[model samples]
Target: MKTKATLLAFLLAAPLWCIAASSYPEQVFQPEIVIYFGDKIGLTDEQREFIVSEVTTAKDSAREDKYRLNVEMAKLRRLLDKTITGEEEAEKQIKRLFEVENALKMANLKLLIRVKNQLSVEQRKQLRELMKDFNPKKIGPSEEVEKRLQAKIEKLKKGMREMVEIGVNPENISKVTAKFQPLINAAKYKEAEEVLDQAIKMLDDPF
Candidate 1:
């Protein structure tokens, strides 16, 4: 249960997937702000329940807004990819995309403000540490290792070229991208590629 809780803490800190693919370094959802504390931040059962209630309420409230915003990113991509669309329409979609993205962020911020006020000073510190640890690599690497890591990252970044060559979904490349981010930061290419291989298999499999 502790292990499960630990996993939830990390995954919940990550962006919530609703309908469309998010841009890289995806925006975190409102519910996840408090859910991040349910396991790793040492909350009492009562406190955890309260946080859960708050998140559930916020998620339900934001559902429609999130879904609408989710479609915009994909819409923008499709519009840009198609040559038939004029610059005027593309400009409008770009403007709407920014507005929708901001609205989604504001919705998250409103809930975060409420959650922030409820936390004690110690809990705030714990949240800070949690965030600090969430960053994959805080330590500096050797010069030689850094170069090799950069090369691997650049290669991984172009999944359209690399992933498709191996018969994986270029569209779902975000799955592999998300899976390897932490490993890439640690310069674990061998392990990272193993993860990539597993992701490729899953992506390639016909349902």
Candidate 2:
């Protein structure tokens, strides 16, 4: 997820409800400003530079956090594949994922507050006007994405167990998982699930 960039952009124009991006706990997209707020709000060069510096830092931090989470999750998946880990370990990693996600969300709020503090009243009002057109409902499930992934993980655990008992082919399962990975990255969990389901059904057919 482009946490810092998404949050910084949201902070510039979105209102309080839209303040933190449905928040980092969810990895869904939302309705954000089409125009650049710094330009529209007529920010001075100094203010713009400050915003850029802070945003770059936050973006870097968020990227690092995301990288770590992906690494840990991959480790946990490997452990599970080898039967070296159990549900408790997987659950711990999931909790850690949520923790990092929450921290990123807070970081965004902090930056948003800092940027707001630096803005003049006129600038704030200009931002408000730019934000008035934002439509939150039109956005898909870009928020609470981790929550969805957690739930999906549980289902996957059950599915794996069922497959093992049925002597399902590992290659077949891998094919389905690989096919859906990109969809998940695109934040299309529903479509990913559909892909998995169709693949499984076709592969499991006795005919």
Candidate 3:
């Protein structure tokens, strides 16, 4: 009886764990502009089709680069912790980490450039706006709404540089925790609305 109960509990928990792991925490490709353009801008079925495919390709490429770099950084951090002894080794680790970070930024920027080239000026604006909305890994509210947040992003870059001069990262867990929680809790919850424009294109299966 005890063994059977333990097995049943494991089976029940396994599905929940899988669901949690598989679900996108902040974003799934629920493109809002896709629906809007289909309905309001009257995108032909073909244009809709091409845009959906292009957008997915760009997003996936960006995500892959981000994940790959994060994994690399984690491995490097463990190696540094285990073996690095002096300031020189630490400096080398930091340099390699920064290079990897810059590469990832360049890759994402190139993908964004491709996205911009593929989209019309107006559509590109809408796409950015849509990305700001649906992209749940958001740093904070929209730049339009958060001048302080925007300024702080720049400030953080400057601060990071200064910290590097003094051999620090300036990444304070307590400070970061204090910075975002108020915004997170006070912000209104918005539901993800379907993108009809993408859906019309999705009739043919772009992903």
Top candidate on lDDT is: 2
Q: Which residue window of length 10 is worst by lDDT in model 1?
A: 21-30
What lDDT is reached at residue 128 by model 2? 70
lDDT of 2 by residue, 1-207 (tens): 544345335533432323445343221222122114455677676665566566668779878876765676565555455534466876786577557656766777776666666678877777677666857554334567656656665666576667778887456656666867655433356777776665555445513
- Superposed by TM-score, candidate 3 places the C-alpha of residue 172 at a distance from the truth, in angstroms, of 55
lDDT of 3 by residue, 19-119 (tens): 32124322222233343433343445555555556556766876776576566556545554554346576567656655656665555455335434555
Error of 1 at 16 (Å): 13
Output the better candidate (2/3) by TM-score. 2
- Candidate 1: where are CA atoms >4 Å away? 1-46, 73-78, 126-207
Q: Each model's C-alpha lDDT?
A: 0.56, 0.57, 0.45
The candidate maximizing TM-score is 2
- Give, for candidate 2, the lowest lDDT window spanning 10 residues: 26-35
Give the RMSD in angstroms, all C-alphas superposed, for model 3: 22.9
What's the lDDT of the predicted structure labeled candidate 1? 0.56
Q: Tell me how far the alpha carbon of residue 15 in candidate 2 is from the true structure, in angstroms, after superposition.
A: 23
Stronger candidate by TM-score (1 vs 2):
2
